[model samples]
Target chain A: MTEPMFRTPLRRVRGLGAARSGTGHFWHQRVTSVAGVLLTVALIVIVISLLGRSHAAAVQILGSPLIAILMLLFIINTAYHMWLGMQEIILDYVHEDKWKFLALMSNTFFVSVVGLASAFAILKLSFGV
Target chain B: MADYEARTSSGARRPRPISPHLQIYRPMLTMVMSIVHRITGSALYFGMLLLAWWLIAAASGPNAYANVEWFMGSLIGQLILFGYTWALLHHMLGGIRHLVWDTLHGFDPADREWMTVATLVGSIGLTVALWVVGYLAMGGPR
Candidate 1:
């Protein structure tokens, strides 16, 4: 669809194009990326601490409230960022409409599965369930 | 330019160029890093599976967690983990570079190339240093 010629000055400033939400993806990708910078460091430290430790040791470390919360935030942010990134890739490479639709659908599904699985794991450990 | 091309009078769309002539051009460091950024980003998608598996195993109790630890301690798994570590670092550095550019600075060609080189080198260096620390934390030389 074509953009309206009489778009408001603010709309022009926002530059949201025909989709009316083009830049939101780009903006949020950046937001998540900044979060990832911090979250990933926390993740690396946690993983390193877990190395050479047994299951019980791992549980003792991860089951802490602060670590669990950080992990949940990491999972959520990473999953959203991943979905955005893969959606862009699929849109670019999967030119056929049907295949593109399938890829996009599976992208969300995959991200959700990974995110939920990880989140569930963290919660299970944290709650001792 | 491709999108700007008009359709034929009969309304048939024509093929269009999609990117800079990548095949014909000499590879620049920035160009290489641009591609690497995408590659590392994609690699992280698969790496996330490893993470999910680890978490799920940990949650499932000792036996399941032991299986995961066995695999992760194997040579192949270590190699995979090493590659994943490098990819994560490279992608994170690349994202920082992009963030810098979004501020509308660092567009100087020389500065761009320098940042790209730094990203490549820094990712490798950080990955190695992190692993060293990790090994030491594990009591070393195992």
Candidate 2:
């Protein structure tokens, strides 16, 4: 067989080890985290504005397309970012092998449920359904 | 390195130290604050369910929404809301701390401590100020 072109001697010899996904996960965590901060601030402002208001008043405010979109965005970012952060926490602390695996799975599941529920609620309100 | 390989292959029993953690190190301010940061981050997870519930209730109907709104105005509900507010503020400050670190600042011992203190104080101050403004916006407490 012909030798592969542009292969370093090391590649031809020892070769590369595992291509870890750690870097992608790290960058994603940071990007989502930054988005989360902005969305969270927007949400806090919305909630504070709604405080002491009647249900109709609050709903009217949220029904506005801008607020509804922002709320949905906030929920999505928070759910994903929270999942990533919780996954790191569980990985670091949950030393028990079985429990660690279970906790990791639960983290994803919980965030998914929360995301779906919140997104559906936002859509329902936005569409007046 | 060679000896490490040999030890592993030989299957000789060796004493291994337990993980370095809270017991090994003296508690420091940053240590306590860092743990609190994680706690607040986690708290936001559960606390946010309240927001979800409110939205769902609102989408359901005006009457259903009012049920949640009324409860939120109750004394106990207010307390929980207050705590949730603090948690949000605190966690936000912690996030800022992380962002600052990301920019390659605050790695110095003194600066890190100062930022830690600022995170705590700033969150409390901001929460109180926001609440004050919120109450004022509503034309003062009823």
Best by DockQ: 1
- Model 2, residue B71: displacement in angstroms? 2.6
Docking class of 2: acceptable
Q: Candidate 1: which pairs clash?
A: none
lDDT of 2: 0.84
Tens digits of lDDT, candidate 1, B11-85: 888665567667989988898899889889999986999999999999999999999989988999999999999
Summarize candidate 1's per-residue lDDT along A57-80 as a digit string, tens digits.
899889899999999999999999
Q: Each model's TM-score, in the order given?
A: 0.89, 0.85
Native-referenced TM-scores of chain A, all candidate models? 0.88, 0.81
RMSD of each: 4.4, 5.5
Worst 10 residues of 1 chain B by lDDT: B1-10
Off by more than 4 A, model 1: A1-9, A13-16, B1-20
Q: Candidate 2 regions off by >4 Å?
A: A1-19, B1-15
- List model 2 lDDT by residue over B1-142, tens digit each: 1122223456975555546767989888888989998899889888878888888887788788888978888999889888898998898888888888989999999999999999899999988998898888777967
Alpha carbon deviation, residue A34, candidate 1 (Å): 0.4
Q: For model 2, how does the per-residue alpha-carbon lDDT over A1-129 read when each residue is reduced to its tens digit?
A: 978787667653343335445366677888987898889889979988987787778878988899999998898888888888899899878987889999999998888887888888888777774
Q: Give the best candidate by lDDT.
A: 1
